[model samples]
Target chain A: MQVRKIMCACGSGLGSSLMVEMNIQDVLKKMGVEGVEVVHSTTSDVHPGAADLFVVGRDLADFIKDVDKDEIIVLQNIVDKGELEEKLRAKLEA
Target chain B: MAGMAEMLKRENVQIVEGVDSWEESVRVAVQPLVDQGYVEARYIDGIISNAKEFGPYFVICPDLALLHARPDQGVLKRQLAVTVLRRPVRFKEEGPDVRVLVTLAATDADGHIEVMRRLATMFCDPDNITKIAEANTADEVYAFFTAPIE
Candidate 1:
């Protein structure tokens, strides 16, 4: 599956999600991946076709459980680049 | 939008002994912003209500929480507050205990990205959180927050 866009979301769409978005960009850069557009918004934006993938912290995982499991990355630690890189790599490879 | 350093002034950063509960912590963390008219009093309620519904997702990393609510909920301006709890507070029984509550009052979704980026840089190093939490004075905490990011 080709991934082009990813959305990181949280309850307020202000803080945590934005932090995750930066982390996603960092991981993508480190992996030498390009052309993946990343954005952050409220959890309300997590819907089918909203984006190729949705990223959120584990606390908000239930909000996006309805989305395809393959398209959602629920981070146990939003600040951990290692976890994000591993999960992003798996999803990109799969 | 003010940069994170400008938004977090020395007066906005504080070190308190402790609070009775997470709710109180939010209230206390947000109190300075409220007093300065950066946000309305309801903003505190907004953060607490959002927490009640979504759990403490703002506890973005261990021992740290970035407190905020929907901009429309009550934000009057863009600002940041750092409240260091000498005694940590836990938002949930299983959640990490938080010692630093960084209150974020953004006027819109995108205005605070730069500030959040600075915070992301600081939080990426967990020791920064510990350092801020252990700061002896508000001036020290303010310096840690406003210091240029490498």
Candidate 2:
């Protein structure tokens, strides 16, 4: 889907979201996928076109229901890089 | 801001037998930072209020939580505290059991990004999580965080 930007979000945008953003950047680097700008912010900042993809923890998944399913990645474990890399690979490939 | 090891002082790390509820867990987690003056007493309340509003958004992974609130809530300086519960606590009726609470007090939105990055590297490994959770002393927990990332 040619994702150029990914936004990782949490309730406050200070802690968990930033962690996910870092993991995403690492995964992207390992995957050799360049040009994707991974950023972190509060859930309130999520919206259509806010980014090519919106990633959030499972608890906060309900908050981003307005976004398209294909553009959303709901993480069961916000700190699980393996889960993130697997799901992100699927999404990027699909 | 200091690195994760420097930001989390030895005195700020603790191992508690258990807590009655997740609220108590949050209180225990942030108490060190509060006592050290990194955050105002109300900062604890801020985290609880935020959890009530957002539904334990800080439980970043199973057995671990990074408790925090907005910068303006009551942050005096950016710092961290670790509370290891011998018995795990749950933030929700069906949420994952959380045993380690890493409380963060950031004075701004972006100031703690590097610290969070180091934490990301550590906590991503389940072994590291277990190492801190099962730590016998505050020094052990402190050393786990302060140790060079392999």
Candidate 3:
């Protein structure tokens, strides 16, 4: 499947977003998933058409109410590395 | 670059390994410098404490080589001293080798630049990271770190 884009959101748009973006790229590469573009953004900057799926930190979960729940994936903690890959892969496939 | 290996050879540096938790990781990373008496033990604790209170920031993933930090604290800032990338720049599961992300945040951008340059010069040696990861004993790691850099 072709993953055109994936948007990662964090509170500051500096730390967490960068971390998630890097991880996503790694996960995609490992899964042999390609054709995806990853971008980082703050909660305020997120808008439709910016990307297909939005990955967010647990703290910022409430901020993405307007976004469809299916399109939004929230992390309760950062330790779920395996779960992240599975969730993202499922999203990209769908 | 002086590299961590050369730094290990210096009289004032030390290195420790197998640190799994965030607090233990900082303690191990900074303990060598403290043993050589370059930095006071109390000071090292302060940094670890601050990082703990402010952190839970980054988590080393199960792949053993990858790291992920809280998105909120993505851009790490440190006021002084040597810095190691707290977050990994990239991840590859097949290779056991781990890449740590580090940044030095100073009072100003210029300070950050200067410190980064010094660190880059100090840790740029090809075998530096290999030596650090392969080290078996704290003293061995310390010796590798304090060694003079060319």
Candidate 4:
């Protein structure tokens, strides 16, 4: 499996984004998926070069308009850890 | 009554103290949310069950223990940080323990400091904390969170 770089972006890139990153990592591990690199970024710093996929929170969804809709993932709430993991895994495989 | 601080002061709110373990702390923190109709009682049970399966400790701090908890739910992880703020550093003798944790999802220290300052102004009254610790019902706890400190 290729180690794809995943960036979790949010308004401040500190609290919520980090939470999502941790959740994603946990889900991947539980599912026995490996070689995925997870990172965190602020909305302003998110660029195509930094990562292959951008996991964004609902509050910052508008900021990523320039990015391809297929490349960006918007989350209203990050509570369902399983759903998020599944979504990311599907994206990675696709 | 809708302000964050005001909503936190309701009378039914109880600030439980001596939450040594993560399970104990979560139970005390979610009680008011269930009692005040903010969250369903079943949800509270679910959180507890999840915590038990994944390991306790959801409060997000600089500490690595938070990461060790392996929270499967993103909302639950966020809630852990928020719950930390709701947990009372101290509990009153008369009422239920404080159940609400207000977390600042700020990334930098500056944001955390700013939110803390605002929270202090809103919920830092000596009387408010005192009365909050003594509150019995969820209504009383809600009053404490909502009431303006004199």
Best by lDDT: 1
TM-score of chain A of 4: 0.87
lDDT of 2 by residue, A1-94 (tens): 8799999999888899888988998899999999999988999999999999999998899888678999999999888888999999999988
Model 2 CA deviation exceeding 4 Å by range = none
Error of 4 at A78 (Å): 1.1
Most accurate candidate by DockQ: 1
- DockQ winner between 1 and 3, please give it: 1
Candidate 3 ranges beyond 4 A from true positions: B1-150
**How does the DockQ of candidate 1 come out?**
0.89
**TM-score of candidate 1 versus the correct structure, residues matched by position:** 0.97
RMSD of each: 1.0, 1.3, 10.1, 15.4
In terms of docking quality, model 4 is incorrect
Per-residue accuracy of model 1 over B28-95 as CA lDDT, tens digit each: 99999999999999999999999999989999889999999998999998999999999999999986
Candidate 4 matches the true fold with a TM-score of 0.43
lDDT by residue (B45-68, candidate 3, tens digit) is 554443344333322232122112
TM-scores for all candidates: the values are: 0.97, 0.96, 0.45, 0.43
In order of DockQ, best first, we have: 1, 2, 3, 4
Backbone clashes in model 2: 0
DockQ winner, 1 or 4: 1
Tell me the tens digit of each residue's lDDT in model 2 across B30-92: 998888899999999999998898799898888999999988899999999989999999999
